[model samples]
Target: MGRKVCQQDHGQSRQNSNGHSNDHLFSTHVQAVIVQLSRPVLRPGFRPDARLWRGGIEGNFEVTISMYDASVGLFVPYLRNLSALLDKGVAYAEARKFNPAVLLGMRMAPDMYDLAQQIGEACRHATVAAALLADREPVALPVLEHDMAGLQARIATSIEFIESLPRAEINAAAERNVFFRLKNGTELPFTGRTLLLTFSVPQFFFHVTTAYDLLRHAGVELVKKDYLGRR
Candidate 1:
């Protein structure tokens, strides 16, 4: 995996009428995997399918790590990136094509098992990035495999870890480079402008949508509800 990049950049902060920073609503790292992962799979010929290029699968997997790193290192920067790509002016189809710089070497494949392995690797990266962003020394990626059961287990574990972080930790900082210490004692840095517009938005949805594409191509009997996962 590539070295984690910081997402923080300076920008104006949005605030609610009550004078509290609205950043928490957007900046705090939400465990969006299930919500993102649950999106209905798209097949070839779909509107945004062009985003799934030769390296689409691998690129998507790499973004998960990027998101984790962004969240821990610079929460606001990640949110800003996410907000820009997800903005109404940006067509969802066009947004789908966005890829972060950090995912340069990830590879895509045609087989289901290989696809599963890619997702597993992405999940592992997410785990490490999350810990590192929290300022702890990096830990080994959890054991994962390509089987459906293994994927489910890994996803469950990742979600639980994400949920455990303090909600305040998700809010945007006044300045960039606010660092968090992870359990292993490493510092992870963050920023606002970069957080919102750069790494966070593009990397996250890219993999999620690609994962859906892979499953759909393989003929998973997926529907909108399946994508939403009972939320």
Candidate 2:
């Protein structure tokens, strides 16, 4: 005899259901992790100087590229996260509502990394504008394109325009609902929930992991213990 609806084998169905649930859970975890580590305070024993962290290894070190490379890897993923939020029209309240306590289950650095955090936020904003104008998904772009002088000029102009506006004006832009229209005239609406679930969450974690890996490879005193912030 066939099993009843409720008793019918739900293993496959359950797995699919769980997959979606896990995606949201993971996204929440990422944001929570970011919030905890992006704080203003530094973690115990973290040296600001790269060489100090390297201990006795003396050979080659280029400050600019070294730092920039790490920062770039760390920043891009966070940027995608932010852009995903913006593209989906997530309210500031919702976006900023992340609480560190909920993320206790996850392993993350105890001290906030300010430079990484700030750059990540900036990337988010920049990517949001780029995505909107290009009529592409927010996570579609990697680092903002460095094409030509004209492109650079336009970005500068946009920044200046936004900066010149009153606080109200900026807020209005942030809140004003609009659809992303492609050059072909198709309109795409921003769906915050969808973006968070699908792209932002995964991309953000990927970048964070990459940054962590780069730091570790560079001889930073980071081990699995450091990621967990455990003694």
Candidate 3:
């Protein structure tokens, strides 16, 4: 008798003339095959459901990489720019024989956080976001970076912590549950991806941008590129 072919939805399986399963046969013949027949089958961690993305699957690990990109590539660099701007501001203050601390308290409005607090909060958001998503231990708590040097140090510490985190550890956190506390002591729950996009990223940008605005308002020689860290 001739060989027979059998197929299943979204995949194919074959049987030989002797009725043996083709799994080993096909594996030997083909170096690689992607059987998207089920959910949670991909490597680099669990597979995503094809149904979740209109027949496309984005594994949790990949999403974590995206978060890392945004957090590190964008967030940390902006903070570096802020630090450079602060250096310029300090020089200007000293040249005029003025107290640099006056600029630390400067804010767009009296009700909002001052520049020092904004820098601290910005660093807090960056480091905390990395920790929360990676399920890693926090390196530092939020502090009042009330001076340019202090704020710069805080930002540098955040960068170091973020850089030290392993990519696999962050991606593995997909299965872990994360939580954040709000101003009124309310703890909001989150999944790794959810926490990164919905909360951490937004909070990070808000504080960073506020710090930039405070500097701009105080007449620091800053351009859009300075705030964006493109230069």
Local accuracy of candidate 3 as per-residue lDDT tens digits, 164-202: 776545645555688877668999998877877788888
State each model's CA lDDT, in order: 0.41, 0.35, 0.68
Give the worst 10-residue stretch by lDDT in candidate 1: 81-90
My TM-score estimates for the predictions, one after another, are 0.41, 0.24, 0.68
lDDT tens string, model 2, 147-186? 2222233334433332332322222232334464444898
- Give per-residue lDDT, candidate 3, residue 32: 27
* Cα shift from native, residue 115, model 3 (Å): 0.4
Per TM-score, the best of the predicted structures is: 3
TM-score of 1: 0.41
Candidate 1 lDDT, 1-231, residue by residue in tens: 355643332144455333554444443333233345345567655443322432243344322223323454333222223222222212332345533211222235534334444455445444444443343443444565434444555555654565454434433232445444444898656553343345434544455445545444543344544433343
Residue 12 local lDDT, model 2: 30
